[model samples]
Target: MRKYGIADTTFSRVDMGKIAYKIIRDEDDEAEIIRYTVPGIKDLPVAAKRLIDEGCDGVITLGWVGKTMLDKYSYLATSIGLIIVQILTSKHVIDVTIHEDEADSEEKLKEIAIDRTSKHARNLVKLVKEGKNALTKYAGKGLRQGFRDAGEID
Candidate 1:
């Protein structure tokens, strides 16, 4: 059996818990979901900490960082906070976010958010339920911003 938690921010339109729920339930595995909603990106770490303290084997934090300069700085702070939370709690905090600039329109943003959230949820299962063996499936290999998914240059 595995237990998981979802930390979502109230400011965003994306619903990470709902996405995670669909994916987790499809696996037909026994698991408990603890949903924690936070005010914004900055609160993600604290909410994740709460889930860890609650005995959740893993946590998935879903949030969005707008393209504004202030939001970007806030995202950096949130990322650092999550790092600290992981070090202190000794638990997995899967942070999934879609930067506002990643998509040019609202619909595009929603599409990206849905894709990122669902995929990361699967990763959560791979880690907490299957252990370290999940690393066998690596990502970002031979991929670059401009090169996209192309293999080695040479």
Candidate 2:
């Protein structure tokens, strides 16, 4: 009965969209999933907004940033834009971003992408099905998608 949207960028080196879509499909069977593929990170905000306008309860935006000053600026802009879209639509827009420099090797990059996208997709399912309270238990628990949790502070 619920509708969810996935907005991904083709600029990513890894196929994060596919991973996310698969995870969502496997995790939630009752919800409807709609996906939009864009050319770059900067384009994700609009895509996500459109999906929300089309009646999605939430949207997951996936993007990859390069190891450059320009890329960093672009990422910041994209992030801000996503926030704006969320505000305008009064919907949840989960931003999942990976920086190319985060991993030293291609294998590591792929691993990070898979882990991050999969986890976020599951989170999306939780959010749409159970609402924000489902995630409140994780507050201050030091959670990380691509890597291990930082653990709770004593």
Candidate 3:
């Protein structure tokens, strides 16, 4: 696998950053992971695009948008931006998103973020070396409750 980039928002600073590195080390130890924390979710595309141009094979981004009307707009904009980045760069920008409404409390947000980010990070190596079916090996490993990825827990 080639060097990978982690482009996360500072909103989920603690959990996002921690789990990104953890999974890279524990699951894909040979990877060279570089992280860039942007101020908000909207900047994910910029960071990801820059990373791709700088020679990263792939990018994984993590962020949470609060349950608000404004946040909904921000989330949509961010999603559209990332989609464009992926299309233009021809690289996968794995977006690990957690909405405030998805969890009842901060603890749950952290739980979901760690679970999601780790899964995406683990997939980065395979995504570069093995293509899109990176984590398909673990498919059907767990139940898909809400928007959380399955196989995160049993």
| Every candidate's lDDT | 0.82, 0.92, 0.80
Give the TM-score ranking, best first: 2, 1, 3
TM-score of each: 0.88, 0.97, 0.84
Off by over 4 Å in 3: 135-154
RMSD to true structure for each model, in Å: 2.9, 0.9, 3.4
After superposing candidate 1 on the true structure, give the runs of residues whose Cα lies further than 4 Å from its correct spot: 139-154
Q: What is the C-alpha local distance difference test score of candidate 1?
A: 0.82
**lDDT for model 2, on a 0 to 1 scale?**
0.92
Clashing pairs in 3: none
Estimate, for each residue in 58-129, the C-alpha lDDT of model 3 and write its tens digit. Answer: 888887798999998999999999999999999989888888887787777777777777767767767787
> Which residue pairs in candidate 1 have backbone atoms (N, alpha carbon, C) closer than 3 angstroms, thus clashing?
none
Residue-by-residue lDDT tens digits, candidate 1, 1-154: 6888899888887776788778766753788888998889999999999999999888888888888999999999999999999999888898888788886788878777777777778878888888878756565455322113456454
Clashes of 3: 0
Give a tens-digit lDDT track for model 2, residues 62-154. Answer: 999999999999999999999999899888999999999998998998899999999999998899889979899899999999999889998
- The true-versus-predicted C-alpha distance at residue 21 of model 3, in Å, is 1.6
Error of 3 at 80 (Å): 0.6
